[model samples]
Target: MGALMPAPQSKLIVRACVGAAKEAARGHTSRASKEGCANFEGLYQDSGGGVVEVSQTKCNIRARNAAQRWSMDANADGIQVFMWDVVGTLRDGFISWSNQATWVILQDAAEAEKKGLPFLPRRFHAVCGPGNVCILREEREQSCRTRAFASRSE
Candidate 1:
């Protein structure tokens, strides 16, 4: 039997254009803790061990949990304009910008129609190609706090 190989980590970074919808921004990565217990000296301690619960409240739950959560939220919220711009370097000595997560964008658009949200500009157009320099522009404007909230599908 051959040894099992681990799945490769995604090289892509999925960034949302708009901000979170406000309700999702409050208490983000700010409120999180583990269960407590008494230690040898009868002092209060985290019984859950040193297992510090990372900010589980963040909208982005690492790469592992993002896709599933995003999909469910897309289905529920009926997202309107979800798009992706991919950037990759070519070994042929050229860089390129392409559509990577376009399928996810379509699914989100369909879900948006099902949920009754604005579904337009669902297509993604390339801005610039790969290189040492990459300048990006966002059509959807939002603050960090708002963006965080907007990104949340919940």
Candidate 2:
């Protein structure tokens, strides 16, 4: 009989952040030690991992439903004009701007409804600010405090 030959070996290298690399190295060392492997050699085995499947059609339908819900809510609040502007911004590929504008418009609409005042498109623009960045309430308060302290020091 002919002498048997050993299976060929291959190395797998992964590049990640420092934290992730350290975590992976720790797991590998633990597994190697548990299996009593010497110098982590000849211990490679392929475990069939399950694959995750996602349906693109379902994703699209969910996104459309969310948009319709937002539209209906805005219309009910008499703020469809502002919603249309947000839709236009989204269509123009300014995703971040659209998100901020939508959030500001919705918040204003809710506040106006609570106070029995109408939400104006002009108010939406003012709250959204230039470049469509909305300063959150916490951030606005922090800025005010900083300015007050600076004025007092001066």
Candidate 3:
């Protein structure tokens, strides 16, 4: 409906925050997704597809025949404390973040409309992992990689 709604095949950006998935659902867009969508009904069509699978569980609700086939080794807490990038497509009204079919992850919600942060509408906040901020990016013509540690000053 607007640029904020993002076009299909676009990337999503989630900025993580601490809150209940239920509250996050109530606090998020009216679209219906999975998990945290406990209280919100009839407000928005069940347009969003796929459930967000956890890192350890190796689950994806959108895949018709997806199997749990990822290694659960190498747990890192550092990834939990900061934000990361997720490249996904917005089909219908759903989002599926994937690593070239490696593993698909889902978010309980997107865009904290009430967060009141300058970056709120520009990012996605999901129930994935430690609730860290997630940013879906636009597919660039050129691939690039940049890494930064928040402990260090910009």
Q: TM-score: which candidate is best?
A: 1
Per-residue CA lDDT of model 2 for 7-104, tens digit only, reads 11211122222211111112111222222321111111011111111111211211112211321222111111123444311111111123222111
Cα TM-score of candidate 3: 0.19
How do all models score by TM-score? 0.24, 0.17, 0.19
Model 3 agreement with the true structure over 1-154: per-residue lDDT tens digits? 2112222233333222333122221222234234322111111111122222322211122222112232122211211211134333323223223332111122232332244322111222222112322233213224433221111111
Which model, 2 or 3, shows the larger TM-score? Answer: 3
Task: Tell me how far the alpha carbon of residue 75 in candidate 1 is from the true structure, in angstroms, after superposition.
Answer: 24
1 against 2, candidate with superior lDDT = 1
Decide which is better by lDDT, 2 or 3: 3
Question: Which pairs of residues collide in model 1?
Answer: 19-147, 19-150, 20-146, 20-147, 20-149, 20-150, 20-151, 21-149, 21-150, 78-112
lDDT of 3: 0.24
Residue ranges of candidate 3 with Cα displaced over 4 Å: 1-3, 20-154
Candidate lDDT (C-alpha), each: 0.20, 0.19, 0.24
Kindly give the stretch of ten consecutive residues in candidate 3 with the minimal lDDT sum: 38-47
8-95, model 1: which lDDT tens digit per residue?
A: 2212122335641221112211112232211111000011111111111222211112212322111001112111333221111111
Which pairs in model 2 have colliding backbones?
Answer: none
Clashes of 1: 10
